[model samples]
Target: MLKVQEIRELIKLVDQSNLDEFVYEFDDCKIKMKKHKTETVAVSVPQISTQAVDLAPQATAVEAAAVKQEVEEVKEAPAPEVKESSTTENLHKITSPMVGTFYEASSPDAEPYVKVGSKVSTDSIVCIVEAMKLFNEIEAEVKGEIVEILVKNGQLVEYGQPLFLVKPE
Candidate 1:
């Protein structure tokens, strides 16, 4: 699994470069990309963790949590410190309010709540986190431009995890 910083760096590189397509492969995962004609960058994410496929729909809440915990244990590693610009010092972090499955949209078929360079207000729902069969809509605590999305869709996130970095206008 790639660390959060690794993903962020990849996004930054994609935005800065002239290339229109990028692909990254790992032993357990693969990320493919292409430029969105309407936008400068587009991200198509697919995470194929063997654990997710093995999870049975009839699995109990405890079982689902157990699987999530196991994946978290294997995936969450200390990310390297990114060298932020002086302006980055002014960027505020939007953190998870609870420990649950972090989702970038309401459902698998829906567009993400926010994207890089998307302008948003404090009341906007930035993401969804499902816990105990309840879907929680996470709001943006600050109004700003979304500079980065730290976590991916369907990712299992912990409490106080950095979900997004915003550059306040």
Candidate 2:
């Protein structure tokens, strides 16, 4: 069982992240939270046949308001497709596979793997995404010339977010 403050903290963390849903279970308490497309959070703290949360009975007005405030602070989700395709027609986007920090180079002193006007093949390494202390190399899946770098180094990137634009060969 989690205290109200702890639950509030968890809610804020989930809201700030790129995750669409989060679930937690400890002992007999089960909490599931999902972010909706309408800028609202749908939370479920289920009580199964025998698995009931003890915190439900203790949820006071103050706690509820605090949790609601935390949820309300979440950033809005990006527009579905209106802002992406309008200007990027005929260009291939190299997107991040996982949420992490984007790095243009292997090391701070090293040169970037790809830059604008740089030619690349199907397997060329475009950047690195550092997640959970592991560095994962992102590849240019399309053979092309780099036309734009969408994100800056050290910026946090969401899953499926575009990192580079390529003009196909």
Candidate 3:
């Protein structure tokens, strides 16, 4: 049986990610979590054995009620639409090579490798992306002047996600 804390942490991770659903199965246990609308999470545990597991007893009644209430409240709320900025239409994008945490500088105290209006060549290191405790130097493959930084420092970035907008030299 999965612990309540573990389930909560998994829900939090799914909430922060771009995934719509998460599923885990082991032996006779299967747990599925789905994101409904915005800011709402719905958990579903299917019966895998003759003796079904009781997850309610694992968590306090109050905590379970609160989570249910929050889910209901979010369900009643409307989802927001996302639109791209018109200013970035003509700019060339520098995308992330892998999914990881983005960092503007080598270290917290160091200056950013590149900024808006900074000139860059194909070989220039623009930022670092840390994945599995390893920091990788991301290069600006296109020679250009950086016009915009799309991602903030220390933000979670996905593979092929646009990190910067450059004006080709």
Candidate 4:
């Protein structure tokens, strides 16, 4: 029987890679993973006759009912306010290309690639984002001077997350 952690790791690997489908077979156990356009990965595990692997505890009827009630309560709640930054109206934002850990420098001991008030061109590297052990250099993409750094070193950033704000030259 495969551990839950192992299954999660496999899903992560498939998500980071370009493969559309992945399959693993062992003795009497078979695991298959498929990626879909909705950003959902489906995992299929055949039933093993040897022993029951309890991946998750089955929810009780009472607990399921409670969850449904909570969902209804949340639907009645008001939406939260979103604040827009007026200062960035005329600024260009350097956004992350992928989900990964942001690095201000190539290495911990090295100076940061760019900082506030630093002049940059379209080809200038503003930072590095480490995804699946691969360090990818992120470009400024616009000719400008960096006015603010939105993300800190070693922070986890998501795709399209603003890393820096720049005033275009």
How good is model 2 by TM-score?
0.58
Highest TM-score model number: 2
Q: What is candidate 4's lDDT per residue for 25-88, written digit by digit as tens?
A: 7655555666543333653322211122222245455644554454334334332222248877
TM-score, model 3 to reference: 0.57
Is 3 or 4 the stronger prediction by lDDT?
3
Candidate 2: tens digits of C-alpha lDDT, residues 23-62: 7886655677776544337533221111113335556767
Lowest summed-lDDT stretch of 10 residues in model 1?
A: 44-53
Better of 1 and 4 by lDDT: 4
Q: List the residue pairs that clash in candidate 3.
A: none
Candidate ranking under TM-score, highest first, comes to: 2, 3, 4, 1
> Candidate 3, 92: how far from true, in Å?
0.9
- lDDT tens string, model 3, 22-123? 777755555566665533365332211111134344556676566555544433533222226887787788988876789999999999999999999999
Give the Cα lDDT of each candidate.
0.67, 0.71, 0.70, 0.68
lDDT over C-alpha atoms for residue 165 of model 4: 88
Q: What is the lDDT of residue 148 in candidate 3?
A: 83
RMSD of each: 14.7, 8.8, 8.5, 11.2
Name the TM-score of candidate 1: 0.53
